[model samples]
Target: MSTFGEINEPSSRTAWEDWDDIFVTDDFLNLRLEKDVDIPKEIDTFIILEGRYLYDCVRAHHNLELVNSNAEVNLCLFKTKELNNYVCMIRDYNLILSSEIVELLKKYITISKDVIAIVTKPIVEYQVSELVSKDYVIRSISSSKQSTSNLDIHFPNLEQPNIISGVSAGVLCWREIIDKPAVAIICYMEHPEEQQIQELYELLERFKIIPDIAKFHRDNLFNSNLYI
Candidate 1:
């Protein structure tokens, strides 16, 4: 039998507009996220969206530092903000390896404040564990550093880790702004990390950032990060 329809198959070209993987919306954001935060490399930008030129737009705003040139690939939200909401199961999960795309992002995306500074390799979990285990790292990095100033970071439309991390951060920030009256949580469809989000909020609250909503969603209906 033959059916006559456009057959809205997944676009082999791109997927940034994917509706299946819905996170938070701009209105939901309530924050003016109109500004497209950036990464340093086009490959890093499209590393999740599946749009090559998209991240080229990212590089124009910031630089995605290449931590290691040898690993498979990783996306690092170094000193940043935005739902950038990306997800990282391991260290070398999603990274930009396309040299051409890298060049384009370098050429187009540049921002006044570097938000999402990415890396080419996954974050070293062992290193992070060591930092967490270090008394100096935790004590010196404490928010009570009288000279420390607050920074409001912004993530792109992302909603997994990058965006989720920011949202959780914002809520905790709000807590201090309002004196710890609120906090939040974020989650993914396949994986909901409530305890993780709460713990994250708790940690940030110590820094005086009131917390709010702590849940997120992801459908992964896209074909690849290069197009979506």
Candidate 2:
């Protein structure tokens, strides 16, 4: 059988470079299976996986549960290489932790009584500020999106005082809630420091959901879309 992309791609003569021909057809659904594992009762003890590698980790480990992502979310993150596997992998996990980062933030806001939200819309910004005014920090950044490679800044110490504000404003806002350096760093970049990444993987080792991320390098990383 042909891979999903091979079957779907139009012939070179007829296809335009700008054409967005992707679709999440019916084949990619209901992939999860029932299983049991000892999940940490304390919310902070469990790890959150995001981006392309999330599917790989989920497919490889029965113990790691699906949290936020679904067919729609997977569709947003999909690239041509992995094709339908990305869509179907969502069904393999037993839990839906939370869908969007903002939802996760709201939970933290309730527990920590501390909030920091990133807003692109002025009207939403005003509403969020008003609702959380007593105990939250609201910072502004431009709504414009830019290519990831355009960013070249780095931070050696995340806990330092008076750091470069608004550098990666979205990431800076998330840093307010995520305590782990690994989580904040991954949130900041598509590709992050190898050592720090290894640190994160090692952290996962404690939970026995270790992903084969150690073998990742520049060439294969792009091809596999593992980092992104």
Candidate 3:
């Protein structure tokens, strides 16, 4: 079992390299499964939710089946009973660690025509007053043919010197290889808040992925022991 630290060891590839050497390991598979777990053969859309905050928000609202998991990540594969859409949620502590799971999933599932990925970045990284004033900023990345007009939020390009890693980057690279269309929604926030979570909930709702937001805030408040 090769650990992520060993797999990510210093490579000769430059910073700009994307998906050059993806290390795949079966060590992360859940031992409960007699054999490998495979994703659904045909998928309407493949959605990847990268952060723990986003994962918690969705899990709070919807019923997701635990397909397989390991110490680093949980693979929740479920279908929306109403929409009949096959969705796979890869929940990870760090987005970067998701790359390994993504590589593993690729073996079992065929890349869907539409891949929606949601990830978060820190506000300090951008330092834009516009972003600071709002709960969060959404930057859309898609193929030229795809329209983001429905989002109704805009921002300047990510600019140079910035690099995208993790499962989001891995998916984009795969999209290019498979000639499929993918949409990546990058949400920038200082921390997870009710408003930020609500915004993401609404976005996923629009995609017919998640159900209505439940009264999770109240539960969190009651469960918290923090004095501040």
Best by lDDT: 3
Q: Give candidate 1's error at residue 162 in angstroms.
A: 20
**Candidate with the larger lDDT of 1 and 2:** 2
Tens digits of lDDT, candidate 2, 103-194: 32233222321112211112222332224332222222222222233222232332223232221233334444454221122223222312
Worst 10 residues of 1 by lDDT: 136-145
lDDT of each: 0.26, 0.31, 0.60
Give one digit per residue, the lDDT tens place, for model 3 in 14-91: 576556577787755332322366656566666777776676666665544445554445556556655535555656
Off by over 4 Å in 1: 1-98, 118-125, 128-150, 153-228
> How would the candidate models be sorted by lDDT, starting from the highest?
3, 2, 1
Put down candidate 1 lDDT per residue, 109-225, tens digits, no spaces. Answer: 221111122221112211332233321111001111121223332222322223322222332333334332212222122112111223323333222222232421112323225
lDDT at residue 59 of model 3 (Cα atoms)? 69
C-alpha-based local distance difference test score of model 3: 0.60
TM-score of each: 0.22, 0.30, 0.66
